[model samples]
Target: MIKTSGLSYAALAQAVNRLGYLAGKTLNYSKSAVSRWIAGEQPRNPVPELLLEVFRKKLGREFTYRDLGFDIAEADIEIRSLWYSDLSTTLDVAPLMWSHDVFRRDLLKSSAVAVGAMTAPARNFLPFEPDRCRSRTGSIPVSLGDVKMIREVAHQYWRWDSKYGGGRFREQLVYFLHSHVAPLLGGRYGEKVGCGLFSAAGEATMFAGWMAYDMASLGLAQRYYTQALRMAQAAGDRQLGGEILTCMAYVANSAGAPDDAIQLCEYALDITKGRVPPRVQSYIYSVLSRCLASAPSSPRNRPAALTALNAAERHFARPLDGSENAWVAGIDFRGLQTQAAHVLSELGMTGRAHEAISVALDGRDESHRRAVAFCKLYLGMVHVKEDDAEAAVAAGDEVLNLLPGLETARVQQGLARLQREINSLGDTDPIRTFNERARTLGDRS
Candidate 1:
């Protein structure tokens, strides 16, 4: 592996040290240390993990310690099994994942995003046969009321996530899933009740994934999403499954794999077409528009993005009687405009982007603080794209004001992008002031 990678021992050592520094450690391994490792000497804790991360990034793939000829522990095997495991194994692994995420985050946080790992779940879901018999034998008896409670809790968590950001209640949600929900999966239940339980579980698990994404734990988020997809498939809930895929597409696009994002969105649209409510379809198209806009700039992509955005707007315009799923309730006109703003901004339609984001921000109250912050950030970006330094500064100031109460990595990432855009315009007085203020708040965050 070392020879094929063409990385000299010193380069390998340097890469490992860079990862260590990012993790708040001081590593000083010399070229000889790398040679010793190549000569069959095992390094200490974190070195093995760091080595795997370095190779994963270098080769654009995932690697386990066992793959690198290091001795693999049983716990490591279980930790790596969630993404590709069968549905039954996934039920067993989900709780373990939550427990580890809460208590031993280092096991998962150090891992790099494996783009390949996302492919199998999306592909396997296309032809998945819903489990016919969901009956399980355990101590506790499950009921529809229990499923309803889980759904209610998930809805509350969604509200909290929108208001305070994903980092605020993520651990609490994970604990609830582990302590309360996982056991219910094992408890005795008939087929109908079992389906409801799995659907509820899928929704809760997808929230976990969204929290992980907002916290910038991309790899961990993918695992949660994969498990959620499995749960949705088991429940025979294609609409929910498609929603999960839409989320996976968003993550993929954010991680610089827009092609994967586009494919996932297409799969989502394919599976959910005519099967879901107009609100849900509108939500899917909104995401598809964003993904299409983010893809490599081409003539085809621009028009395709516009078309998808139009579809989203059209779907959202249709009348609704408030009978949509709990998850689809949040996909309102403001959210659609927010997505439209993103699509427009990515396609370089600066004026349209500004208008769309302004619509998104209109009448935004305290309940949607995080969403408002994101819109402001994007508005700042659009201002930069338009070379409007003063407006950009104002947008940055608004984001700085909102930064204190939010715990989302995505908002911080947006601020960073805004900074980059400002920097590209050359340093000036207002830009300098905004940068200084942003730096101060960023340090605190």
Candidate 2:
């Protein structure tokens, strides 16, 4: 028989801390336990998996139990893909996805692509009959039957994010749903009721992912997106599947994976083909523009982005049917224009970018502080690029004031870029005032 060497607990803890740096998050660990582990102590169940995470992150390699000084074990279990009828299992998965974003940042960034590799070949999961399942008790839960209520709450939270930015209420919302709302999902109900519950869970999970993404927990965001995708697939919600895909594409693009983002956007478009509402289609196209804007600025690529913007505009111009959900339908020409503005700004087309930003600002409401802040940020950058220091400082001050409350890393990147521009001028002029304010804003953020 071959003997496997175990890691000392202290060595294990040292390894985890090293891995945390690579994964871009802090790991709470001590040397003594790691020493214990190396002394042939089993490190505990979750600890082993966390060890795997550490090695995988730092070494760019996957780990088996053997790598952690344990006897080779069978592959760790994937979270079971339970149907809505499986209330206990579904509940198990919901909190797993919900709480993951609180700490796991690496999971949010690249895991979507990691999952993509697993999912791309099979496109869908093993089929399960929706008819065979029943709720825990014989009765359906009230929460399951009332999906609109959950959607309304989600919209309200989305609006809150738009106003106060994501930092204001994201954690509060997650805690409420995870603590109070999630229990009801595990209650007894028929298949009909169970499906509704799963659908709500899916929506909530998607938003949780979005909140994490906004907060720059890229790894956690990706994990939540993957969970949301699985839940949507189980619920047979094509619309949601598309929405999640678009969101994933946004994250990919944000992370500098333009090609991957474009592919995901195309996948979203193809899945919806003919069935998606025009407004939803426009929303998807807007995200496509975001991805394509990151593409190399060749004559061809620029036209491709313009084409997508035009397609989005066409969809926005269409009349909505009653079946079109209001939140989805509310995405119109102005929203497309807003997206186009940002894309133009990113591409350094300052003239066109300014035009689009002005139009977007005119149409956006005062309560949309996130949007307002972003537009000002863009305008400030444009002014700096145009060598208008006074104009840049004025617009940047507006961005600086609101920047403290926004949790999005993209927002911080914008501020950083602006500071660099001001610093490049090396002027002790009032223009440098923007840099100081931005530094203060950075500290708060």
Candidate 3:
């Protein structure tokens, strides 16, 4: 297994020791010790567990003692409970997941992304019915002010994620959710306060999911999204529920499940029809546009994508009467353009795609560095498709400049795609310079 993973014995030993230190134990395991373990000599307590984690991280999947040919009893690992029958059950299960996310993040990060797990939440939430009473009778008392604080903090986290990228503040947000907000969920609160608290908690949880998605931890993101949907259902916030489903759809599309993504977007649009504000409707339609565009290209797909995009634009032009949910309030016209750019690009409308991407880039400020980087990447790819090497190189250069400050895997992946596009443009001086600079920056990263 170690040979198959391409890890040297010394590297494996170092990884084990580092994991041990992180778990608050200090031990020196030499390469020879690793060799002995490989030769069928069992290591004592905690070593086996650490080895499993090391393999899990390396392989991007869960591992067991049996899989490693270790002659030991397989430890019963706790599978995260995602679905719940009632509000109380959800409250109990969600904190456990958050706690694991905070303390056992390695396991969560390497967990497989289960596309099927998404169905239950959407199935339960689309009915638009509120859960049973959310009022709790724990020792601590929760107030509307507390709920307000959670919402504010969640908004702040969103700003940080947009600016610094998810790798920077994801752990802090999960810790905040697990340590501060989990207790509040179990505290004493009236019906009104309970609804507000659940809504606030749902927003925070969804943000956590967004951060996970940003960091390329798709499995962890899915779990957080599922729980957020559950909380939204309990809060009876159909708008928020729809928004969460849209997020799930985005992640689903990114994970190569366009069918699931389209279904989720359809659910969001169906459930929130006539209930949400224009901006919220625009957000849903925009996501639907992207999902439809991602499907196998066909005569109907392009028209369907354009229709969704048009619906998004029409709804976005309507005047805001101050009733928009905070969750969808940030989906401004520029945000809609970003999604439009993607749909157009997928539909092979390079000229329109370039125009839409430029609009998105023009509207964003410095605080949205990650978003700007993504827009630039899209612009570069569109330039590539247009056979304009100079323009593409220019946009790629801008993305390169932004790469050093950002810590997002999505941006890295985007840069890789940009590199591939530039590589396709022959061996020109500008292309050579761009690739060299990209290589240097990537090495530094």
Candidate 4:
């Protein structure tokens, strides 16, 4: 019997895809080919050599034929041993169990210990307590290693996609979260590990929701967010729960449900009252401000926005302890300022909006290409409003330069809005010509 690495199918698939893509193949071999190899049909002649070459290039390592061996008979036995033999349950769960190893190479190695062939559900698959695990675990109970790895991957995707355009990766992440991780939530673990798993799953689910929102799939995003909220409740992580509620409010506000947004934000604020870091509290308020801005004009809306802005200001005025969640670390006061600028702009408070934009721009890190694109768009919009076509055009051009790097949908939407504004000024103006150029660049790219 050939003793191979015992890598899960997904890892090998990822490796193959990476190799094929690097080699510039128009259409690489199907996954079935690898499936066949794993099924114990020995690669004869040049194909075996080709496999070695592909793996070496893909993984940056050398391998002997023996290194990739597996017994044909054992393939089914090994797979069934790793997961339950029940096809129905395995269909629902194998992906999620295997996904654990996807994030951590060591976990995959450990998984090769092979689940017991007792014909019963694995030890990890606990009975689903509908009442207890109703929503996201309130407090995560899993090991620190799992928590850290999930966070690292989530943050990496968040930052990278925000800077580079979600494109196919956005879809890939959503699929993996839904297909490869959801089943683990159904499996058993100790209370400690269970809570931790729920927390990590909840966070990953929320991130999937964010990507959905970026793709303009509001309905799907809502579902993912709801699932995330449930996972948070299961983890018993109130802080994370509150944060996710605030995120849900953002989705609501974006979809024109300001009233819904306001209610959700208030609920989150109440839930986290006094327990959360000031940074989180500030974030909640910033989101609330968006709700207030979008709400129908009334004394209540004005006062609400003002109150939220004031509270955010007070929070930012204080020095944050280093213990805050890393996600909320750099959330400076400019976020509040940006919110103010947006609201003022909507209210036709042009001077105030411009002033706020200036302050926000000053505070923004231009190194973050997305932030620069946003600032430029906002500034351009302000100029367009003021009939400063030349200035608007200049700002729009800058937005175009950064557009190649910006992956956020909001930036693209902002650019479209600016283009409309420039277009309203007629086709012959220099501003119109500049807008046309920017539009072409985006369209062509």
* Winner by TM-score: 1
TM-score of every model versus the real structure: 0.83, 0.74, 0.81, 0.65
- Which model is ahead, 1 or 4, in terms of TM-score? 1
lDDT of 3 by residue, 1-445 (tens): 8987789999999987876664335769999999898788989756887787677667866666788878776341223343433566568668878888788878777755666555557887867789778888999999999999999999999988989999989899999999999999989998999999999999999999998898888877888888898899889998888899999997888888888888899999888898888888899899889889988555687799999999999999998868776657776778788888878987879989988987898858888899888888888888888888999999999999998778899899888988998789888999999999999999998
In Å, residue 356's CA in model 2 sits off its true spot by 1.1
Which 10 successive residues of model 4 have the least lDDT summed? 113-122
Task: Tell me the tens digit of each residue's lDDT in model 1 across 1-445.
Answer: 7777789999999988876664435789989998898789988866886777677667867666788888857334223433444556667668778778778877776555666555567887987578887878889999999999999998899899999999999888988998999899989999999999999999999998998899888877877888899999999998789899999987888778788888988888888888777888888889989988887566688899899999999999887757577768776789899999888887889989988998999999998999999899889889888888888889989999998879999999888988888778877898898889988888888
Tell me the lDDT of candidate 1. Answer: 0.83
Q: Once superposed on the true structure, which residue ranges of model 2 sit more than 4 Å away at CA?
A: 1-91, 99-140, 143-146, 297-299, 404-407, 425-428
**Candidate 1 clash pair list:** none
Q: What overall lDDT goes with each candidate model?
A: 0.83, 0.65, 0.83, 0.60
Candidate 4 displacement at residue 302 in angstroms: 3.2
Ranking by TM-score: 1, 3, 2, 4
For model 2, how does the per-residue alpha-carbon lDDT over 1-445 read when each residue is reduced to its tens digit?
0112244546667766654443333567787766577688885444565576555445544456786678745332222221121334345656654444334523323332233232231143223222235445624355444666767787788777767766677777677566655666655666676666666667777777787677666555555666667666656666777888888787677666677788888888887768778778888888888778778655677778878887888887887876665457656555666788777877778999888888878867756777777788788878877888778788878877776556666677777787778667658668666667667767765
Assess the local accuracy of residue 290 in candidate 4 as a C-alpha lDDT between 0 and 100.
68
Model 3 ranges off by over 4 Å: 1-78
